[model samples]
Target: MKNTPSTQGRAYSRRDFLKLSGLTALSIGGMTVLTACGPSTETKDSGATDAKSDTASSFGEGGKLRVGMEVAYPPYNWQTSEATDDTIPVEGLDGAYADGIDIFVAKKVAAAFGLEAVAVKLAWSGLIEALNAGQIDCIIAGMTPTDERKQSIDFSDPYFIGHYGLLVKKDSPYASATSFADFAGASVLGQKDTLLDTVIDEIDGVNHMTPVDSVPAQLSHVNQGACDAITYNVENRGGLLAANPDLVAIQFDGSYQLFPDEVSCNVGLKKGQDDVLKKVNDAIAAMGADDSTWETIIARQPA
Candidate 1:
């Protein structure tokens, strides 16, 4: 694991999911800043036929690194209507582009593999299936690789290390909370199929509501008083607060306990693809070696 550049917000890690799962080309001289659809849940088919049909000799034009993401996770990844010096036009989707830390990371991996980077928009629940079916090459969306996820697909070295936190209305009673226990008996929102959903159980008496698809939806629930708070990556706290100033991010300190495997995010790859894995890991290691570069990329995002 590498040390992630610190932002104005506190970063905490999400506990491991036993599962796995951005962009832009704002040039920092040699880099570009840039920027999913899918089922609501993982299906058994995994589109294996599609993966077989799309097999290529190696990772750009011959076989661009088809990366899948939800494009709804801001600060990590998000969709934009226009392509700019800071965004990449999504493949197979018109009038849409992407930007954020994930995009920067994807481009680095693609460049390392000597391939082109193509953004594939897939539903968060469907990302794994897309990868298994070959709808995309890999998943770089702030996904944490756990033992369970490793059984289905391989994960490269972690590119981003983060922790989970909650987003609540600034004026809400929970705003000054110092621990998950503070939200006890309170309604909480999280994305479907994500570790955040399961982590809510740690809140003791929390009212874990049904999960939703996007951050916007989760935040909406919080804003509307449908829920008192929502779980998210601590790295995204700054972004969340920036996007919704009315909301405050609560990250626990000594009062919170995170297991060892809980909070690291890594690159996800198809099973038995060590060749591609090495390339991505190498890229990640190289990127980690230069903290300034990572900080520059992080600074580019609004959050």
Candidate 2:
């Protein structure tokens, strides 16, 4: 399969499909559940985590720019034990390196800021918490900037635009499904702290299972029949389908419009940091304009 960037721009609002009211209700009702199982609570200062407030200091004191990511999402961010020209050593993990589109974006952002790029491996759920705790400088994970997330951390202009899709077992009833409404009552799973999980409610009567900690867990649930399907994006298609041939990605018809914000992945930083944010945005814009380099990076991803 030839990998190429999507020509579609983010045209829908994240708030339009997944209403903020519903999200707020979910957050409030699921507060206890999230606190117990969501991201770590370790923070640097209780009062310093506001996403709307901007701090004036630049990232890292000198030339060191520490960028954090789950290092688990594929073709976008993933682990590589061996050293390669494209690999960046995981800051604190011995013998492991980070590679993928996120690393590419981080390197460019670092260069724009005149800093050395350092990849900080983190758990998906702990990314925001670590940033708040000052453990890492910025989050370059394939994270979408939802309205809810914007309250706690500011985000740069999208660096990578993704398209949504569902992964289901080839033998499952949903394999032939054509739309979101076709999966009513079918169990589905998504990763925690992601719009993927929240979008499950859009299916109306889907038996939305409890969110998991990682993509591997979601894959296990579906492959084992614990769930009928899982939510993912276009960039994930090659790696995911290759890893499990028994599963296939469902490309819904054109009638289905996705929440644009869900497809827009950006660099996340603590509130303020206008200078750093501008630099990051500029880097992303520059990268986006250069289709050749972007295509080459995508083509070189591990299958």
Candidate 3:
């Protein structure tokens, strides 16, 4: 139930997800300028199991815990120029900052470990690699703990649980869809390299469009009629609706669950960091079972 910094407006563009090959140092006072990966559909093998470093009770150098996330995603994480007491400055981004539920939890974990919390913006695909390569200490980017990913890295317990829903233009014929079967031939879209895109195949006979690179791109495709619909997390319903009034959510009946419950959300980390993983899990558990705090953060996300 705490307020954090947020975007001033909801207008979005493709530039929001920038891909750069420049190096981003995780060590404090080490990086003068930083560049990060952009969104892509490809899912590269994490190979995290083979990327172990010396085991230490603490993480990062210079008393800093570098946390990685896709700052462009709201509710989970987003970039903003406004700095409040609750916001963490995005490393290497002069005036910009990061704020959301992910950041909230990141700060909590950093505090528990006695380190300065720093937000490192990264591409969706880069999060796992960054953690393994030591470019980041942890990933607090609303990542799910899939068996495939677990093979490469470790994960904290679930933080925010949300249902999967589709977003369609408010006036579209498919706006009234009440079940997955209602959109047999519909052209559905999803963010590249995400569970959202993976679930689109469940709709029988549906035309699954090539996944876009980012959520902003997904919103653009649905808003501009480039696609009939896009998959999204239901927890972001309020913010998404407020930002794009022309869109409507199709919450299908209980015939099938579009998203699996076990993979709701978690903090991802590198393999062999058993101590770090335990500390991260402990930090998450300390946040408790009440969803109210997490929901409030979601509700207050930038529209």
Best by the TM-score measure: 3
Give the higher-lDDT candidate: 1 or 3: 3
Look at candidate 2 and give me any clashing residue pairs: 51-152, 54-271, 54-272
Instruction: Give per-model TM-scores.
Output: 0.75, 0.76, 0.77
Q: Tell me the RMSD of model 2 versus the true structure.
A: 10.5
Task: Write the residue-wise lDDT of candidate 2 on 1-303 in tens digits.
Answer: 112223244322344323211222211111111111222322223233343325323467557788878666765776666678777777756777777778888888888878888887666766787677666789998887777778889888776666556789999988888877888889889888787787777676888889997777788888899899888764445556666779877755531233333366788998878887777777877764343444455455444
Candidate 2 residue spans exceeding 4 A from truth: 1-58, 254-262, 288-292
Write down the lDDT of every candidate, Cα atoms only.
0.63, 0.66, 0.66
Tens digit of per-residue lDDT, candidate 1, span 87-200: 666776677777766888888888887777777777777788777776678898877665567788887766666556677898999887876567777888888777777667
Error of 3 at 274 (Å): 0.9
Q: Model 3, 1-303: lDDT tens per residue?
A: 111112222111112111000011111111100112222212233432234555232466878888888777766787767787667878767777787878888888898888878887777877887777777888888776666677888876665554466889989989888877789889999887777787787678889999987877888888899999998866565566666779877754532224433235677887887888778767776765344455455545553
How much does each candidate deviate from the true structure in C-alpha RMSD?
Answer: 8.2, 10.5, 12.0
Q: Which is the better candidate, 1 or 2, if ranked by lDDT?
A: 2
Q: What global local distance difference test value does model 3 have?
A: 0.66
Model 3 spans with C-alpha error above 4 angstroms: 1-58, 253-262
How much is the lDDT of residue 77 in candidate 2? 72
lDDT for 71 in candidate 1 is 67
Q: Which ten residues in a row have the lowest lDDT in candidate 2?
A: 27-36
For model 3 the local lDDT of residue 43 reads: 27
